[model samples]
Target: MTVENASAPPSTRRPSAERAAALAIQHLLSRQDAQGWWKGDLECNVTSDAEDLLLRQFLDIQDKKTTHAAARYIRGQQREDATWATFHGGPGELSTTIEAYVALRLAGDAPDDPHMAGAAAWIRAHGGIAASRVFTRIWLALFGWWKWDDLPELPPEVIFLPKWFPLDIYHFACWARQIIVPLTIVSAKRPVRPAPFSLNELHTDPRLPNPSRRLAPVNSWDGFFQRLDKALHAYHKVAPRRLRKAAMSRAALWIIERLESDGCWGGIQPQATYSLIALRVLGYQLEHPVMRAGLASLDTFAVWREDGARMIEIAQSPVWDTSLAVCALADAGVNPDHPALVKATDWMLGKQILRRGDWAVRRPGLDPGGWAFEFHNNNNPDLDDTAEVILALRRVQHPDPVRVSAAIRRGVRWSLGMQSGNGAWGAFDVDNNSSLPGKLPFCDFAEVTDPPSADVTAHVVEMLANEGRSADPRTQRGIEWLLTEQEPSGAWFGRWGVNHVYGTGAVVPALIAAGLPAAHPAIRRAVTWLRSVQNDDGGWGEDPRSYLDEDWVGRGTSTASQTAWALLALLAADERESEAVERGIGWITLAQREDGTWDEPHFTGTSFPGDMSLSYHLYRQVFPLMALGRYLRAVQQGQSVCGTSDLPR
Candidate 1:
């Protein structure tokens, strides 16, 4: 908390790291709310902003201020080529561009305007509307700009499928299921609002907007789904009227049942947006309590900036942010009984989900005690957040030890129960890796399956180790599974964060904490991999494109968050004295701003791998402090960061 210059030379390691860590800890503490929570802005691409405007237009509730502000934000995301991309420094994406263009049009931008005209030209050159994804087309069809028949058919009757069925609601990823169930009603009803303006300029040819294409070979998955879709379309014309009505009613009820206390379905904009549309189509009036509450929840996602641009967060992350903040603060020399740590721990305990959610479908006997990513997503407590929160809680000496212990026990039990048969943990659901959802023609945007990833499994493993369960049979199995998942290049795939850096950063520490030796072959290979990929400037950054191109793996311009992640892995492996480690620390200290924070403009967080990227504003702060704190501890204690376990229980 004292004033010091982090700009000290690299040779002066202790002073520089100490000053930088102190500045970060103070800055982070300043950000904590009175109720003991830290929330950073969760930023995604322009699609959320576009979809928000589209939702208002569909509901006939467009306000001038919101429209202008949203349009400004959307325009600001446009690329030099007049197209929008899903992530920073990525190629132009057809779907994102189309959505942003439509949102700007809704804000009253004329097609003939210079910027608008350039975007239209780019859209036309890229096969126009036909080249966009199915989700984008669905939005277009709602306004009569595209025909409903051209899109994939999603019959509401699918909701009647048994839980044992391949494509049942439970089989899809939790986020996808929330949106899919409501979309089934939308697809069945096919209601279209009248368009206020024509999108002829966005079409390659107005007369044949959706050109027909030949299906793949019958033996292929695409062909089978294509034929199935055709049959479903045929069923749409002749299905029994009574049965269809009953199915739509069932789907509508399903959507309403999952609404959280704050009226959000999963604290995600798309899920809430589509659910509202489904209910509205089924005759739910705008003034109805459920409808009104749902509408109000969408407003919470808007993050109005000082420049008057209104951007929309795809999902909120207070719970996730707070848990990591606690870990960072506690690691950075904050006292175990410090008020900040206690309040954060108390807040986290209160946020634990005590009721069963959709994850219980597969584990009916397991108790509910996991944590969700958002403030009010009780129905979907993710394993990643739960594991991290438990670790954070373990670091604090809370006033009520019984309560903390009880919470930790429940969390560990739930986490252990939620593990897949393969001995790994996914973010949300267990064994939610059904391939049917991805093969379906309707799901072309977000990842529909929730498979176990190294990062999540690592967190759970680390949490289990901290709880003295390191030698448990289940923990050993998880460790074995992680060993098998290592890539030939010595990195693991990062499902939730940006590429190899995040995954390797997460796995190394967990492995080390679980009793793996510093010189283990796997650890050595990972260290070599990390050092080989370090930026010439001595920090680490991985571009989102690594999810698609192997050439880009573990390569990008340095950022504070990513550099910290790599350093954490190194320090955990007893590499505090290595040149790579020292250079990384120097980069972090020199990169620190006068205000005790680092500026990270790249999309370091992730949602759907290559399809969607995110920028968690707090990642730039929390991770660096955590890494620095661990490094200082290693140096001061004359031991590995993991070996110095005298902080707290």
Candidate 2:
């Protein structure tokens, strides 16, 4: 399968290292959670074999029934060339294919099995064992399929660098830093053992590249970063023993302190699993509290199938899911007085954290009032949750005024404080605009560090404006930032949601809330862009490519969620009478599933751009409800809307 790469150039010129260093320090200072651990999302290709192996090793559930069920599911994903992809319809990934092949082997599939043979051939054809990433090679080395010397050096001594250094520990993204901290200890110790079988058949070359060899020249900036990595490796040897030991001990304690009750580190799947194994090799016993809890947390990550087999999800998202549901239901006109609404609000109120979390470091002195994305992820409280929760509480008429008011004050204050000097806000981080982290040669993904985005900032602005605080300086600056961030074509770049449609939908409403007149130039420009992009089916849809490619604008078959997003934008701009709104509403009504949900496969939310996408299942219901409710309200008020006659069938 062919996949297009749509990585955009850095929108601005590269920052000087001095400037970047200062920014990194500033960003780091803002991200310190009250609990004293830095946290952020750990993104990886979810189809990796690490997860499959984790399920078997931790749960001891490699029964034949479970094995065959999982085998069938994995085999079904094999591409025409007999390999697997990290993403749907994308090129075969070497690490993913290797891991999948190994996973099947662990499930008792013989190397000679037709499916296994096919996967082996694909691996050999692609540079086989030699072409896989360092992380993949290290995993193999752990089991002795590969040699320790074949992996890049990730010495513990690197952690000793002062904070001001260009490649200091703090320079890496929070996720990378967390994993690397523990990994440094594991690497310095360099422990290796044997796997059950040899991967000799998997390689076209019997020998792997020397880890010390320079593979590519330091030509471009990315190339320069790779050389910097090599220099760090050189420095690894001959480092002072005292400093090395101190850094390792500090890093180890750093990792240990963040371990959640459930044996997982930071309650994220990758860190918890990898760190558990790493700590075990460092002599932590299986029965130890940290290890046992980490192992048990693996169960929380598993989802049982009808076949009695299980697939491990990277992490659960109930808090994020629930918040979106509440907003959707509220927008759909579910009265705040409804029993379900009341129940949800009460539960949400209970969940509101009254004390500061790790975010307090980045947002020093702010009152502790925000929500997290997971029921238990206290280390990573998010702005998205805070905004949604505020909206939900505002709709609840019977909420205890004292508690609700206090929560609102804390949340608003925290959010305002979290805004970057640029006048926008990131989701889980603040002023996380350091460019050096993304320039690291070890990084290949887009958005290595979180920076404020149009969608998230817009949501926060709208939430604050709805609270009757639109006139505040912070809110006004946020509005100015949104106006400035808009593309020349009038569209806004969506960082957390899909492409322009999501960004436009969110920013338009926020602009209106910030007191921009309906006829404001920015609002008009955004409305025209939405109208121009509406699909032929009387709805709106944008492919994920929009995140990667500017040229893929206006692409994808119309879907219910995108259509609803479009309708909401037009409604916010008082363009409900337009043909685009008519068609958008028509698409939503026509596509409604029998259960009152809409069926669409495209993911509507983005995490790390170009790497992961999320299908917010409730987006269809909530957005349409919101759009339809507003449209109906306009009609009742006798507004001269463009397409009132074309309500969905």
Candidate 3:
């Protein structure tokens, strides 16, 4: 394949390598599942576009009512300048604004429609076409709204870098790495063509005349990374023919091996999905079986309804949800023989990874022993899942000796191996704190890195303690780190769940497990902090803003899940007999619906502190079960129980 002449006017010539890449990508696509779905990055947020589109489709409100309602929601979100934010009331992001505007257009609003004008005006006002993120620009370029040269190069050769090197494939966080792999091929090819429509009004300058030079200052980290990328591009251009071919082939195979049957590299998340598509455009063929299956898999990810069509989540949470539910019920004092408990245990036992997954890289020689968020994501198995799964399994009566023993050993080993040198554990991988990845200018968005954190470490300690191995040095070190990590305000910064409530809920139990006296200063301080935050509603709820604003700690409309979390912390501290625990349990019981479930409208789980939020539907059921079970047990032991009459009006 000949390099496209940067000096020569844009040519129609298709490089042979580009064709080969496309064929390879298409081949990858053919491997998708019979169900039309492609797994990749879901790109989660408070205003998840996927959720908005899903609601529209599910309600079958394609008529003016639906349009008007959604439009009202979208319009209300627009800033004074007409741009919308990915996060609540934050700076306007071009991609979010673009998606929102497109949704509005699909809602039957015309370009000149006042709201439409306002959005377009805002897009232009924010450097319009020029100021968007690389991913955003890539989408626009795909349809000819933006030029290819304006983007950074992503040569596949970068994948060949050794794990020890800076900017190596391994240096990137898993989420970022997944997208970058396919993007490398796409960037190197730099394919551009015309689109069906013009986005002239969306740009501050004519698309053709718009400057394509790198945006960040050369002295800045982003600029440095960009320059390094350009150098990689030059190296790819002149590399030995044999070496280049081998690198590309290796990269292609690496991607193919990881392709889930659902046409997604991992599951139908957007990053993997888009990467799959980019690979296809690079010349992968459909009949190659892998590509064919992958393409078919993409179809399963599409969710169509009367109002509009969007993507179905590539991943689901039956295993994680059920396990957490089982634990919650058991902790709440539900009989181990409860039908739900038995079923959940049976399901979880069947779901254990008996063979090693990608985690084997850092934790080699350990048997596969962790649970994944989705039933299928073997490669991205989580440390938290392993801990929680083991905890749940331990509570089950009559677990299979062989399976339980084996799974626990594997999980314990994995968790221990995942501990960083600093004696803490991260959610997924260990030692994922490269200084370079986050410094890249292109990574202005939050969450380009992962490090060991207090919450995950506490979970590890609790799990180890349950295994009767709390005295182990590794476990002791983790406990020590957690004790040190507590905030001056007496709370631990929760990395995975919502704010202080989650951190406190996790820490108090872990401390208790580690043999902290109930009256220990740290324990008492945590108890006092929780009690102070209890709402008049006799429940506790903290907004996501708690991640940003300390003053907002424990402030929000009381919800069943948060209340349960607070209750769990109090109970773990031997405070189950306290007025606060009684009130908290009452609030949860009162909030329960006739169906035995509680209302949980808010997303309580977070990934990259303050950026992406998640709602585990089972959080409401499980946490309350845990709190109530603990409370009931304490009361059965002659501790005072809060009466239903004491619940908030």
Best by TM-score: 1
State the lDDT of candidate 2 residue by residue for 1-649, as single tens digits.
Answer: 1111211122211122123223322333343343322222222343533455734543343457656666666776678887876544446777788878877777778999888898899888887777776667767777677776555566776667786676666556556676777778877767665467778878886664332455565577766766766676676677778887787777777778777655666556767766775677677877888778877776676656675545555555555555555555454445656655566666777767776655565666777778876656656677877887787677666456687778788888878878889888888767667887666644544456777889888889888888777899998999999999999988998887778888998889878866777899998999889988877667777777776688767567676667777877788788765666655655555565444545665566676666666555445545665566666555456563222112211
Compute each candidate's TM-score over C-alphas. 0.98, 0.84, 0.80
Which candidate comes out best when scored by lDDT?
A: 1
Work out how many backbone clashes candidate 3 has.
59
CA lDDT, candidate 2, residue 462: 84
How much is the lDDT of residue 483 in candidate 1?
98
What lDDT, from 0 to 1, does candidate 3 have? 0.65
Q: Write the per-residue lDDT of candidate 1 for residues 538-575, one digit (tens) a residue.
A: 78999999999989999888888889999989999999
In TM-score terms, candidate 1 sits at: 0.98
The deviation in Å at residue 123 for candidate 2 is: 4.1
lDDT of 3 by residue, 369-433 (tens): 77776646667777787788888777767446576677778878778877888999887777888
For candidate 1, give the lDDT. 0.91
List per-prediction Cα lDDT, in the order shown. 0.91, 0.67, 0.65
